[model samples]
Target: MAKSGPNYKVNGKEYYRVSLEIGRDATGKRKTKFFTGKTKKEANQKKQEYINKQILGLKDTKTLWFAQTFNSWLFEVVKMSDIKPTTFARYEGLYRNYINDSPLACISIDKIEPMSIQRYYNDLFKKQKKSSSQISYLNKFIRKFFNYCVDCGYIVNNPCSGNKISLPKEKRSEAIAKKVEIFTDDELNKMLNSDDCKIKYISLFSLATGMRRGEVIALKESDIDIKHNEIHIRRTIATTAIFDENNIKTKQTIVQEPKTKNSIRDIPLPNSLKSIIKKAKLIRNEEKFKAGESYSTKNLDYLFLSERGNFINAGNLDKTWAKFLKNIDIPHKKFHTLRHTYATKQFENDIPLKTVSTLLGHGDIGITADIYTHVLKKQKEKSVDILEII
Candidate 1:
């Protein structure tokens, strides 16, 4: 008698087998193939191999365009890969902005060659004048998509492989020559003394702690240990687009863990900053009282709240920073410049690199050294001046 189901005994030996439909034969008869192995896992693997071989042998795969294949890859492969929401949103944004309607996207997947991708990148840099960084991001997405295609037998090889593409030389050099920007001492002093209470407090807090904008806004009263003179960096507020079942996108602000374990560290709270924290608390209490029942109860422990009594929006923070700079008669700098300024000041004050790195919550001390190389060079100059005094 023949064995039943997936498990069977063939000549008194155990075996696992699976039957899969390959296609429909001529005259509409169903064609099937059996894959057998010692174990069910092995049998499944054999079945997948056969399916992949059949897909590779199909001539109709040449009809699959890049746009269609990209959508299929995104929903079927990328979406199921367990990436962060922010990262997925970024990938979606890159496809929409750079790849969706481009000429390259209209070509058949199998027809996409190295030079075809190279030309697309060249046009982005030369004709569109898009930055090298932007093109690099687009290239990364395209390369990953093509790699998936190759793995799934849609293509024989990835055109992006083997270093066949590169950015223009001048654009590459431009990106390499970019320098880290930071606020000057005078600018920092001006910002700390701003008449705008919100700006003054947040600026002082950021300058004092060297916290990222997201980390600062995500801070809660509970994270502060006044007796210990320590402030804990726990979480961050990120704004990312969330996609629903139907692929509809909505922007949302979410509190998430810090980017890395090193990002969650404790730093000593300066005595001067203590007074500012106290004042901020008093202001929040006053606002809560005035708003009464209307005050937002969500995340009430948050150290900073907008006028509407909700968590501060990252976009609104940036706009406020820009307006504050303009009002103070200072040249506009990114909010991140405050962080750089703090690190620079530390290096200038002869603080050890390791100590500075830990305070900044850098995962590696080398990262701290590289970013503040200019400051370290200046410190070296000061050391030479001391030698002269000796």
Candidate 2:
């Protein structure tokens, strides 16, 4: 081999090269840095940084590629924060899907371009069944990672930083801003007439008060005030995480306070519902006695419980709810649609927005407004009462 200056040739083009002319050294072994610059001096300087980083047992900032940099960035950036476990796991999934299989993994950091990054997203969107919001979130994550890479001098620019990939804009689906079906008085009465007393009470409570399933399960007898005719909603329970198809423990269940401060408010009870709940509470207590178990506050405290007298899981609630609907031979909507029905009825009856917002534990009136826009539009038109003045 011809010994030469820090310079080399590939075909006919010159590549500035730096090869460490030594064997094993104080750090470990010999290293070589090959780079293409307009000049040999630029290449030599680049080589020194590589050698320097190796000597110090650090990654060379100049030579890190997308694959290597992102791996490092996960630890360097995400691991240091106090992010939720679910959120960290999601970021990991995104990186595995987007950046792991690309040519960008081996492509030198300096060579990445906006066009390549745009294509990555375009491919992901085309291939995956993710929602628009999910894709936007993934894009934001990629853009941020590349921005960090640029700030640290691993790359010249963020390939994804300035590029705008058009995601399909999500208009309101057919269900949105549309008059959703709410149970009429007869329909509500038919559902209330259940053979299973547990299902009957659950239906009555949900319809009258509009508490969510999790919120309903988490409710304590102490949360209800018969004299005031009110039920307080303060907390919710949810499964910790969704598991993979393999049934591994993919996530933990969480029992925490309600999502927003407004979620902690009390709902005024209607006279009809107050009477039903009072009778149901008496029956629930009598069953506890017949089961021959000590009725501790924890066991009997909740308004609803399983036959075993434990707080009912949402799955149990769903199963029981489905069975009730099937036995009654009634058309059904999701559990949430019951709450939606309640809110819609309230809006149609001309109850104020602020009052409905508080009952539903909405974070804001805007969310309520968006969801019940169809109900509200109808109510607004009906408010004129043509016979009053004419």
Candidate 3:
């Protein structure tokens, strides 16, 4: 290969030359390829492109469009991975919403630059009024897709890397400043004491156990250990999409493993909650006897069942929760707030952070600390107050 040299004027036109080793010749001799450009940087870029093309074994890198590559990566690569179906659906949704018909999708994979990705993110933040967190989620997908491209030798560098793309500082600050909302004591009392029988037991169970709504609904009668006074969490119900032979998507509910290994755990049940469990079981038994053969055999062992004797649909549960809150004259909060309230109460009671994290089935103690930082801060203040007595 020729040595690198400064740009020189050729026939009154400025030009730069770069030499790169292509491969061995037929006689096993070293072979070099030369690239010429108007600037040294441009010459180096041309050489890098040639190396990328040879690595990909593609005669024309321009033939691979971003949209087509994304689709193929989703179905061929990501689908074959060990991710959950719901996750795959989320990936497809992101593609359809952000990348499917966009100008970035039409660009060749080889031409995608960090600036290109930065512009798309900026547009989403400014023009579409997307939240910083939403843009961050989109960035995660794009970054992973570009990483896959690099692993496949389709590209030399990820356009999303090196902190080249990001949300505005104000937007990022806003996101970080947002705090987790928990139910107030008054709101909790109203929910636990509400006359709405359908949501009452489940709401209390959530407050007691800090289990996610999906994990709570996926409970079976056998999961309740009356002898040990414990509740075992093993599975969760998730809504995912199924693609038919022609690629038509149909939504369905499925019982799958917990979100993380730590999510599968046992919680010590309070005696009051045990009694509530027994009452709920008795009521379900009475309903089952009345329904007789009409009762769904498939859902027999499940603790929470709909009127049709099927597992509770997560969507319907959300609606029921909303109506129950409205009837109780409380402001609407997401169902997840129940879980947050339980965690906050634990911290308020001075429970160990590791114990609270374990009960919540958080994958890491740091996650529990991060989510309940405000609660932890209040606890610290209380401890300092005690020290003032000295």
Candidate 4:
């Protein structure tokens, strides 16, 4: 490269010399040049400085792959976290079906962009036509995946940002009716003296204390407090079963504990009902002994037991309840209606809301009050009588 002579320009009566120099590329492969302020000295300084800095190896992007980045990111962020088995199964299913085993899953992180994510969502909707909620869930997982890529420097930024779809609301179920199934005193007497001792005890205890079917079945001998005249609601017997993909049985059984913490509570039992439970306990022990087993050998502590002395399932309890109602000729009602009936009866007898709330084991008095608004409306109607008398 050649050095050109300084070119001078006069301005404000002072001469300025602008100079230029040309040099080889800093990589030393190509010829390069520099230009500077009105001096040959400055031009040479800039050219030499540029060449020195380049020789020190300051460079730009070399390699970027989407799939490699995504895979690396997956191993880095998601592999160790504790996620629900069901949730992991679903997410992994999506990955296997659509992304993980596919070509797009391998796209370079730097090359991944919003258009790519938008296209993925479009393809999912086009191919599977998933429900709004399903699409929303898939979109969320993809967004999270890309967010991880961004955090790990695999990608400069998340492509799925600002993409969101709202799911439709699910319809609410109608509330159960609150009609009081007030049996005639004679019917009540007959029911109390029913020959089917198991049904009779269950009916008496349910009606007396207003415990739910699950609460009734989950009762353990130890949970009963004879001195305090109370039944402790510790666990509930609801059945969930594992199944093969063909729906063939893997295993089936009962789970203890009611669905909510509020379901565990203390319910005051009627004296008459307590006597029945005490007698029932003795009968259960005698039956166990007859079967060459000890009552102490009973695995579960539930108050109710099957022939095998295990906690009863809901289906079995329902069948027994239906049979008892039919044999007694009482109005047919769902088993849970017994709980409503109990609460309604308490309200009819003018029990305080707080007391009823506690009896139902409601976490909030407002919830107990809300569920029984129909009963409360009646109470308000009765209040008119007080207004008239006053």
Highest TM-score: give the candidate number.
3
Give one digit per residue, the lDDT tens place, for model 4 in 86-187: 344456566656667554666655556666666666666666565445666766877787777566444455666764333332233323353344555566
3 versus 4: better TM-score goes to: 3
| lDDT, model 2, position 188 | 69
CA lDDT of each candidate? 0.83, 0.70, 0.84, 0.64
Question: Per-candidate TM vs. native?
Answer: 0.77, 0.67, 0.82, 0.53
Candidate 1 local lDDT, residue 310: 87
Tens digits of lDDT, candidate 1, 1-390: 976554767788889988998689888999987878888989998788667757667334645899887987887678888777778889998878887888887888877888988888898889988877688778888889988777776777889987888765455456445667988778877877778477668878888889988898888999999989999999988788988777899988888888678999999999988888888877778888899888888877988887658878778888988999999989998888888988888888899999999998898999888788778878988665666787
lDDT of 2: 0.70
Please provide, for model 2 over 259-365, each residue's C-alpha lDDT reduced to its tens digit, 9 standing for 90 to 100. 66788888887787766766767777777777656444455777766665666666777787888877787777677777888898888787999899889999999
Task: Write down the TM-score for model 1.
Answer: 0.77
Better of 1 and 4 by lDDT: 1
Clashing pairs in 1: none
Error of 3 at 36 (Å): 17
Candidate 3 off by > 4 Å: 1-52, 55-59, 167-173, 385-390
TM-score of 2: 0.67
lDDT of 3: 0.84
Global CA lDDT of candidate 1, please? Answer: 0.83
